[model samples]
Target: MKKHNWSIVLLFLLFVSLSISCKKKQPVDADPPEGTESNLVSAEVTGSYNSNQLRLLALAAEYDAAVPFIKYDVSFIKINYKTTYKGNEIVASGMLVVPKNMPTAPSMISAQHGTTFLAAAAPSNVPQFAAFTGYELLSSAGFITAIPDFIGYGASKNVIHPYYDEYHSAIAVRDMLTAVTAYLKKEKTAFTERLFMIGYSEGGYVTIAAQKTIETSPIPGLSLKAVAAGAGGYDVTSIVSAIIDNGTYSDPAYVAFILNSYNITYGWNRPLTDFFREPYAGRIPVLLDGTNHASAISDQLIADPTALLNPVFYANMQNSNGELALKAAFATNSLLDFVPATATRLYHGTADETVFFQNSQLTFDKYKASGASKLELVPVPGGTHESTVLPMMLNALPWFQSLDK
Candidate 1:
């Protein structure tokens, strides 16, 4: 078995994490209609930035001039919105970045962030840093951007993050967009009603999930224009099998996260010891408690799946009929079946190890075979999971700008 490089995985999480709603007011005199109530719970202005100030911030963040320069001053607002979780309604939080003084009605983007365990790294919590790297900077480029905290953090922090769960992930993005649309309309922020999606890694999975939901179900007042997803684990079963079969994976933290998330999200209620080895299993709950960073968690885990996971559980996961519930969950959550109708581009680093480039390739091939003419696959030469992000952004931003009309 190849000894994986832990440092790169650590750096990937650190670098990506480092990088990467309101309610309407009720009338005093008369109550609003029952179904007419806004999805938006509340919005609070966090900060405002002028174009020049945003330009300097982008430069400091190392974004090249090839990317769109700051074109409009922007306001950052933290918003809470009503979104569903496992058939129950709950309030979730996100960051809404609205551009000021645009020449025309600006388009909107649901910018999803890569995976992060730390709550502080959630977009609404770290608005300024997110502004430049996550979604805020794009707002400065004149698009209204909404970055949802994705259920495990922000207002829904107590809930288990349904990592890689299709329905939960899709609803988080969809409802946030719905809430944002209501908020923008309430505030009289002019937007073109053209919606775009962008994300990398886990965000990439989320972008695709949201795109599929919107394209298929058709959200009222939310029209998806285009999307760019990079290095996502869309083929969930294949990715998990590869990890188990390969014996060693560079990022054990990710493996733990998925297992734990699946266990909780699916109501499997399996003990961590059923999946992971003793000491690591004992430590998993503490490691994933929304305070530790991914790097910190990775530091404590072994890279070899055989060593990190229980021998029986690992062996069972390899068999088709074994671990039936978990297998069903993985199959259900995988994004392989959908053929996106909207213009879409799947981006992947050819050398990416964490989520594997093959995941995207397989997805692109499937979509193409299903007759998705507007789909394209973009390979970032020599880009690893961490390195692929900047290049992906550089290419995606321009492409999104071209289609922004």
Candidate 2:
């Protein structure tokens, strides 16, 4: 009789323990607060360039005019488009470029910018860097170009730029296209009927997110023809592991940007004082502006981001920090998981040092294994992440041209 009583007591305790554990493991609600300014703002696109601001505007417009015309004929026009998402007015400022004379093209390609310190503010100057080499090639091939400065980057008003939040990035892409389409319909502009997206690095992830959103959302009059992602840091979990394991060659600005972005998004996670540890954090922002300057690379502004944090700080980062929250957000808003079993083109350089090519390969394999019928993985041999854009564009040009046929 005593044995039976003890067994019952033990079973009761076990049940209680399991209940507590399950409660603790329950996920926090991932839905962002509605009616918040970030959630309600509409996107507006405009050209702030004028003759009086010629130098800056010229600098801004240089990429559209110069880069695409390098090997083929291309011309671009600057325009502003606006739209609302959620409940707030959001503004997106960008350029629209197409082949010099092809007015009746069948497809439009939206190119996303990578992790430049300037974000998309200096779009005109970005294409010169090997990072954006594909933009020109895509434009030259008669694909209409639409690029957004992701919220908080260019003219958009926001405190922190969402680093890896696919929803925010995807929305930016979607709104830009919506605005452009509206403009075309209103003006009766002759252009392509199909919509395609292309992006690299940070932009590549955004491209994937945008494609997923478009496929699922109720945005009328928009059709995604195809998508191309190159060297995108798709899996943030893996990227964070790489940063923690290999502290060398990590960009300090990226770490700062991530920390800042997370703190802004989830202030409850960590205190602001926990960030900007020392002279390094204080001075890092100034150094970021020089990211594209030739002298900056030699100064070793890039270093292991993990090295800057102690174990306690790192532990805090992993726990309540926005990085994990961002991941949860992605999982909750996984538009890509439901992507049609269509083939989306993916390109990655085997020797990419920035974002691992294996990551791209894994994503491609996952999609293919899942019965994704419309997927293509193109390997760029003898190419690194930064050097493959031009070649990828060259390879994609024929494909872009085929959309018309």
Candidate 3:
């Protein structure tokens, strides 16, 4: 009897151990997670604007109320659209706020959000730079303001928000613009015929992509008059190279974000073991969640890939011969390969930590060479990336206003 009891106990322990091990081995859900679309698809206009227009106006109001900013009569609209890349049904949502009692406003501004938050999420949160820029102020100032949630944030479908890829970002922008314009034209709400684009940080990069796409694609109802991009990641390769060469503290985490984005978008052509070893490989999923806390922690934990990880992983990443294919894949120019020669207002702080001011200069020079006559590169003196909005806007608003003529 005693022997039989001991055998049963041992078997139970073995079973429990196997279960624990299996749990540990389970893959993390790092890819884009799923989310439900908001029920507020369209709004009802009680006054002058029709139902669709009123809905956009209501959304803008909600957005204004959500954040502590000057209130504008804003409306919210949600769009359900499909993209080919992930076969995922995406939602392009944003706020459309027109000036009170304005008729035939000459211009529209599409405000793009920065790197840390989704465009739709920005207006609701105070910490987000987009909210501070007074987009509401812009609307009250008689500009038709349109803010998109990009591809992943808010109602946008899919999980992997493509980093600096202009194609996907531009598509989202174009679609949102189309929806808003259609709503306006259908309702006969007279507003700006000329369009303007504005973005900061990741948003700045997105604006560049959208401008390029509008110039290249045959998308209708897009009358881009002026574009303002500030502190944008114009050149991914150059930015990464600068981080590596300068030994900036944030390089590793930035690299980690890029690697995770690329790896998930274009999964490993080679074995995963060839690139990342042990802990770093395991942490990939955690780092790519697009959360503030995760980004901050990653910045501290990862300084240099070669120094932090094991020799095998470091060698694989640094090895020209071994990583030749992977390097080549990564070496492809994600930005600046397709910039439009549209009238542009570029802003950068001399002391930007994430995206160097030099990148902005290089982009300006390239745009000039590309026969872009209406380009203005404005450098904010003694300004860092974080504190650039007010000064950049002061420079941009006048220029944007001039485009109306």
TM agreement with the true structure for every prediction: 0.90, 0.71, 0.72
Give the worst 10-residue stretch by lDDT in candidate 1.
22-31
lDDT of candidate 2 over 61-164, digit per residue (tens):
33223343333244334434453433356664555554445545436788887766554343432222222323634555456677666765544544355677
Q: Global lDDT for candidate 3?
A: 0.59
Q: Candidate 2 — what's its lDDT?
A: 0.57
- Write the number of the candidate with greater lDDT, choosing between 2 and 3: 3
CA lDDT of 213 in candidate 3?
76
Worst 10 residues of 3 by lDDT: 24-33
lDDT of 1 by residue, 1-405 (tens): 111355335434443443342222332221223455677877777666677656555545555453465688887777888899888999999888889988888898899999888877778874323223445778877789999989888899989899998998999999888778777777667788788899989999999999888988887777788899998899999898988888578888999999999999888898899999989999999999988877799888998989999999988997776899899889999998898999998999899889898888899999999999999999988889987887777777788899877
Order by lDDT, highest first? 1, 3, 2
Q: Please list the residue runs of candidate 1 whose C-alpha ends up more than 4 Å from where it truly belongs after superposition.
A: 1-35, 65-68, 128-133
Candidate number with the higher TM-score (2 or 3): 3
Per-residue lDDT value at 60 in model 3: 36
